[model samples]
Target chain A: MSTGSAPPILETKALTRSFSGFTAVNSVDLTIGEGTVHALVGPNGAGKTTLFNLLTGFLTPSSGTIHFQGRDITGMDPERIVPLGLARSFQITSLFEQMSLLEHLELALASGTGLTRKFWKSVKVLGRFHDRGMQHLEEVGLADRANQAAGSLSYGQKRALELALALALEPKLLLLDEPTAGMGLEDVDRTIELIQRLRHGRTVVFVDHNMHVVGSLADEVTVLQSGQILAQGTYDAVRADERVITAYLGESHA
Target chain B: MSEHLVGTSHLETAATAAPERRERAWARPLYLLLALLLACALPWFIYPPIALDILCWGLFAISVDLLLGYTGLLSFGHAAFWGSSAYITGIVAIETGMPFPVAILLGALAAMVIAVPTGWLAVRSTGIYFAMVTLAFAQMLYFVANRASGLTGGENGLQGIPRPFFGMELIETEAFYFYYAALPLIILGCFIAWRTVHSPFGRVLLAIRDNPARARALGFDVEGYKIVVFVISAGIAGVAGGVFSSGHGFASLNDLMWTTSGKAVLITVLGGIGTLWGAMVGSGILVTLEDYLTTLGFEGIGIVTGTMFIVIVLLFRRGIWGSVQQAWHWALGKARLRWG
Candidate 1:
């Protein structure tokens, strides 16, 4: 998808974050090209999620510069970053449990349309966006359950709904953290398909432990171990890297 | 095949979906009209002064509901708005000789001014902490009102606050139709409160209440929204306070008492939190009970009221009016599932 001459759309320069004296994310420079899906892979506690949080502005970096399309966005609030064409789905499902699936979609649609502050207007008047919300739900195959409570959805359905929410923003860059966690084989396949279909013309950075998913879907892969990048290349290249084999796969095996 | 967008709107389809649903919609407005009619007739049935007191308390309870029922913030300092406005309105009316509406506006404005900073600081902590913070602020106001004898008339309070008659000091004549005079303002305040709860802003407040972190993640300025709603709620309380001071002919230290805030909370909870009209119902019941009990020389009436509140809360989780609506929906849904 990249012409190879253009600069990376998102870049982190020696980003580091520490909590109380424990460095969750150490100095790591990551780059993601335009219109490509990049996978962040590591064993547990490798700081993949912390890296995602830093990029998404959920957590401020202890020290580092994060740039999106070459503009600095190191400490921007998640709300501010979202409108800048960057959206994210959480590692754990972040949802309004009491709200219906349609209501969830409506809120995302409302946020995208900048209608959240419209206090005088009834949300029923937002009927114009109802079809659009349904369409997004359809994308995730949750259309039939639109009226069902979000909390009532099965674990896999919740994950699908979470993706649908991020997609509702129609963002240029989507950061997905463990998008397939807790999903069954069929649900994971559907989720992967949905992500694949939606990845066109968008820059995606995702973290997953599933090597098969990373191997098949990622245009590039960055492997991390102990809060540092162990390898970065095409999936096959990174998978074949000797240090990766020793530090990551070898460790997992042992 | 392309998905059909369900061409008709939700309300448009309601007629075909269920006759009961259609009737229920119509019944809501009809019920409201009847309630309004009853409210209009209340002065004839009860002493006008007691009815007027109920209307004032209704407004105050609605203000509390705007935060507690809708936004999910339990404020223990609501009297800070109510009492501050009572004092300000009385003082302004007595000293400045301002028109009734002007005095009310000034009082409401003063409430908004206090709400902004206190709401700003209080919204930082939620639940019990928020309640404590608001209570602390209200206590501060009470102390100030107690000490400021020159301005607030201290323990004696601002007594004999003369109600204006078209900018004329005809306190004697003006007292005759005080309920009728205050009715329009109360109606206007209720209408505005009703409009606000049904507004898009109100929906966000509900979402924030349900899940603040999720609301924040969805790009809502939760703290900022809280402050705005707090100020609005305070302004509404101020309106109630203004009416009370003018109607009762005094602004006393009792207005600033923490128990006043507790009463507003109790009234709201009793009617049904989040039900805008329920506040009025709660206030009406509470005020009427107080009036009847006091007239019969019933002492320690708080015990009776407290026991009733516990029974109501335990039996009807949604409060009186809300429980009725919930039960109706449950029955309707059950019937539809079984027979329809």
Candidate 2:
């Protein structure tokens, strides 16, 4: 996070999203520094996922401005925002069941590069772009399973594919909502390694219930509680906050 | 180990191993040559009229499969686009001396125009709801075609459709040029479908169809991709319908019916929803079956097709092409195991 010495790459200003009478996400401002692994931690139903959804354009904010690289992107479609160097991965491994694992990466690579459609005689000629897809797959240690149907992959392998797809976006900022959810212990370690490696290219905002993951990776942490920011600062700083402990971790040496 | 080699590389693995990209480029046309053979040569061995019918429906299946297989939108209203184009082609060619190709182009354009609005509405709904909305809209078109006796000639259909061009006049029924002329267009149509399936955008369409949220989060315009596929597929289907009307010297409300739409769906399912070659196979089998049923004077081909659809859905979700591919992979795996 440049020791908090530079301007934020992504910032939320009074962002709020409401459905009918219920407000799932409330107006709460936060700044995520450039190249920082910003951890968003909260107990269940604490609006962590909702805030992720709003930020990534899955859900539009009802009020407030969202700035990415100093550009206002309050209510842009998730699809439109992807090319602007903002990409996300789902908590679940949302992938094509029928296609090869490599094909998934290829699609993501094509998308991230804005090569939406090419009416050429042979798509195989675009091997340069295809090579990048292979690189992404290799980064996740899935070069071997490149051709295997993604659906046939084990749960952990699918999670790797999900991460690979997000990375293929080549985004300036990445929002990962529960990236490690439902993964085995071994998978958690692999995914953590993948996230750590990704920090070289872009900032990552990841949510996880696992405090160990949060403490190990988060450059700074923001603790959410009941649709509001309970505490924010370094992992230790948020961990020591009385309000964070009382509201979320229940104060018993948590 | 064999599984790893054969795994997914069966489709385009050669491209990966090739040292020169230009050397690998020539391989693309071989697939087209084979498709041309199927469309052009096969009719010589079969009844010309029947072969022509298969070509028409094969084109239609390819069109529908482009959207359903590629984009993952199980559209039921493609018949609205197809049937409307037929009516336009039939009415125009008969009323004027416009060439058949020009009329067909008009039909395709009409379908694309309709597709944008319908696709816009359908894209908002996901999964089964999207399928239902498309079906409802198509049925609405079916009603309009059936009621518009003045233009479309209603249930009885418009007669005296002309097949202009093809070097002098040719009979719509026994025209040998149907095989020669229509065959090229049919091959070209299949080529478009083939290219789209293998292209970069085609890959993204499959990805979005598979996982919209993931595709979107990866920076893809999922909605835009779906709409684009829908419009393209609808336009292709319209051209197929135009070919059908001009070839038969008739256009009717029957073309716009729900049953007609279901026929294309049946072909897509039977062939393999996602596989391009499988679509032609599906179209061939379904068209042949319907023709046999007609000759037998069997009143309800629907009963048979409906049962087959249910059986395919339950027992073989991959359809014909998918199952064949699966079997081929299984065979390949077994062979490799034996070698080991």
Candidate 3:
């Protein structure tokens, strides 16, 4: 799928997943090159999130192969895959409800540093990660609210914290499901900026319904419809495709 | 914008100024010292046997709390560990003539060994399923202990289980002496449980408890944490059982009964679920009340305990210690505002 200097960082071949009799994700091929920001945009129930789950190893594919950094990660548990430099953010906020924002970042840092298994040391000793956690908070513009309980954060702020958590993992490939979902215009802009900042040296595959977010952030966009890719190209070219306009965007937008 | 900043900073200051670190550090140790003093003086106020009973049960309850309060893993069959340890400790003492610490250690080890497999099976399931599996395993152990009369004394139980000694007969020593002897084990058990819950590993357990799926997604081995905690909790429960057997000089079928597990749960809930010390508090209160009721010739003391448990559950959703801690924090918040 790539003839350039670096091979694709992640690739999927003939990925298919079915729930009972309903096929949620049909056989699909995907190639994400190193350091590329690829977007998976689709209308409601278009299997975008399903594909994300399959690629991240959260959901097992009925028949397919998932290759991450050229290693077969098919049916691997998400916990195992994450340590190999793949991390994901949930569509919904999934921060620890009782933990403060700083603690949430520290938990991620602990995983990355292999400190979570250290039973004898006090969590306070992981204060070594304090400055880095604060840096993440600052990156997400949440420095002031680092001490606040994560559950008390506003919806948009929670999404930002979720992004900070993913970033703290320092994954080689980042998967964000609806990184800016259900946000106000101002929050959308902030999240877009955060994504831009995060994409400097990382590979990213994100799912979003917002076309503008996709167009601005994604170097290449894949249009999915009814569990299959309808089109894949540069955002502008994909938007201009007649089938995408009719099947996804509708003639009104066209 | 300047005024807004001032207001937010004021709130933050008020929130963070609860108590100084030095002062907060002293609070726990000070409480521990006071608790030790009280445990020392308890035999003077109450009958020595009752005092010893409270301390033993207190350890058992705290062991249960390690799983229930901190990790959100509730076992309805904790008696499998406690009772099995009691029997092992008692048999070891009677046959091997080992010292007190060694016997207890062996018993606790046996309990932990059994916990490994049960925890393996139990942690694979969650919530009610976990509870049911534990209960089922405990019931099987209970029947096994019952049928193995040659080893466990069957339904009659292992009676006259000898206590450990330095050189002389320790069981023959005054109950007060034995009470003092048992106090350190209880305190040490509590300290171990406290330290584990405060460790970074403990934080991972809390993370798993709060959201297993999210914790797993964050690259934590959720089931692994659960099993390790289960083993630790079972080991502590075994310690409690060993102390109980030595103190009572007996190991019986009642120790392994499902009701014994229920009692541990009730004690934890009554005192407060998440607070580690709440288990001991609950045990003290429940045991004292039951003892007093029985002394008063009340045949159905269970009714009174049941009623009190209902009231505690209804009124104190956070349990006694949790509510008390909340109130303490609130008071500190108020004090900080007034002084600052």
Candidate 4:
């Protein structure tokens, strides 16, 4: 395990979330070190998404304490959480369908700056963000489709745009839910490369089913089954765990 | 196979290339100039009072469109702001004898103040719940106005709401004179709506409308934006209401009735939801039709308007202006293909 000398960027103590009477996530503790690429891997119904929801404050935990950058952020609203250097991407590709790709990045950029409150000014003021917006689109290889509407993009392209939007936030801790969930082989490779290039100084916690992605990019891997962590270590160490094999990896990778 | 693929791709590019160049026709300088000229000539064509009605209702409809079209909010209690502004303007004109502009401003301010609490409660809900909440608030205000007869003149309404002189004795409170005086304020209100939707703030509103969850994840205060827009819309509606009451020399309980709120919604839907200028077009058609039918001693105006609304919805689901915009782009694409 590469739990290096770096401090923890995010920590959760006894996080639990239940719906109706069924518990989706049950008393799980997690620590993510600063500037490390971490992956949460498991089979279907492993409660990985529920954990993400809890972390991002989309869903309030039934019982837990979440500390980010050494501050208590438990039960904070999603809108409030994002400004505190925590940003997340949805598992489903959510975007403004009628808005152009450049407009999407420009909006993300505008929200960070105080330009969103300038209702009286002409839209020409947004011209200042044009260069930076295009740079973001170029990062995802979508510069050519800058003016095109988000609804017209291919599925793989939409996934790339999603990453671009999250990256635009410049978060201290980034949470991505299934970055390459439905991508083809070529797109998967491209995304893996993009994440490798982008995760230089940021802490990234992603949930993925692809072992190949986990093997390549993740510095540390955590395996969860039935809402509890079964194992946590480096890629090879987690892969070699006996319970992980019997529960998840054995069936999927067999 | 490669040649066939290349040919199909070329066709696709041609089809998609046209729309990127097609700007909104209503926003063009030439069209705006034409519209301005038409506004200047309207009083000559119709009864001066009817012309004033068109201008006032146009501003009201545009205010409704600002929330309904851009923000994806459907408020059914807009009449609360409109009617409240009318009453406030009437009272100010009667009590202080302030300049008409000052009175109108105060009325608009009052409407914005009322919107704060009402919008705070209403924006917490979505879809039909939002509409119902706004409607409930309006109904409550209607009852309050009914009971407060000393202030509001109760069922008889506030009469003798004078249109104060504007320094020139020749410019009296005649319908024709008043129509010109009110035209600038209405235009200013419309311009504000246009500027709002085109600004960065407006871009965020569109994003919230399309996906509130995504907008919140992006760090936007979604409810805050809704409340702010709701207040601005109410303020604009108040301006319309102020002008309407002053021009008619009366403010009645009918101004605050739920049907007045419904009229704003109907006019917005009749023109086009998201198209800012469509509100004015819808307002013009509605006001003109009502005036014409009433002058002919016809009481079935609702049936005619209802039928027209159904036909518009069935034929042009995007409403009149939205469909026209689509067709304009399509025709431009066809022309480009044919010429080149």
What is model 4's native contact fraction?
A: 0.51
Write one digit per residue (lDDT tens) for candidate 4, span A178-241: 9988887777888888888889889999999999999999999988888888889999998888
* Chain A TM per prediction: 0.94, 0.93, 0.94, 0.95
> For candidate 4, what is the TM-score?
0.94
- Candidate 1 lDDT, A211-236, residue by residue in tens: 87888799889989888988888887
iRMSD in angstroms, per model = 7.6, 7.3, 4.9, 5.3
lDDT-wise, the better of 1 and 2 is: 1
Candidate 3 residue-wise lDDT, B1-340, digit = tens:
2111111322344344223323566687798789888889999999998998888788888988888888888899999999999999999999998877678878999999999999999999998999999999999999999999999999789998777678655444678778887777777778778878888888888888788878877888888889988998898899889988888889999999999999999999988998888887888899999999999999998899999889989999888777888798779978989998
User: Better model by lDDT, 3 or 4?
Assistant: 4
TM-score of chain B of each: 0.89, 0.86, 0.92, 0.92
Worst 10 residues of 4 chain A by lDDT: A245-254
Q: Tell me how far the alpha carbon of residue A197 in candidate 4 is from the true structure, in angstroms, after superposition.
A: 0.8
TM-score (all chains, Cα) for each model: 0.89, 0.88, 0.94, 0.94
**Model 1: per-residue Cα lDDT over B218-319, one tens digit each:** 767788889989998999999999989998889999999999999999999899998888888888899999989999999989998898799889988788
Among all windows of 10 consecutive residues in model 3 chain B, the one with the lowest summed lDDT is B1-10
| lDDT for A171 (candidate 2) | 83
Give the TM-score between model 2's chain B and the true chain B: 0.86
Model 4 per-residue lDDT tens digits across residues B1-340: 2111011122234344313834667668888899899999999998988888988888898999999999999999999999999999999999998878788889999999999999999999999999999999999999999999999999999999977866644344578888888788888888889899999999999998999999988989899999999999999999999999988999999999999999999999998999988888888899999988998999899999999999998888888888887898789878989997
Chain A TM-score, structure 3: 0.94
TM-score: the better of candidates 2 and 4: 4
Itemize residue pairs with steric clashes in candidate 2.
Answer: none
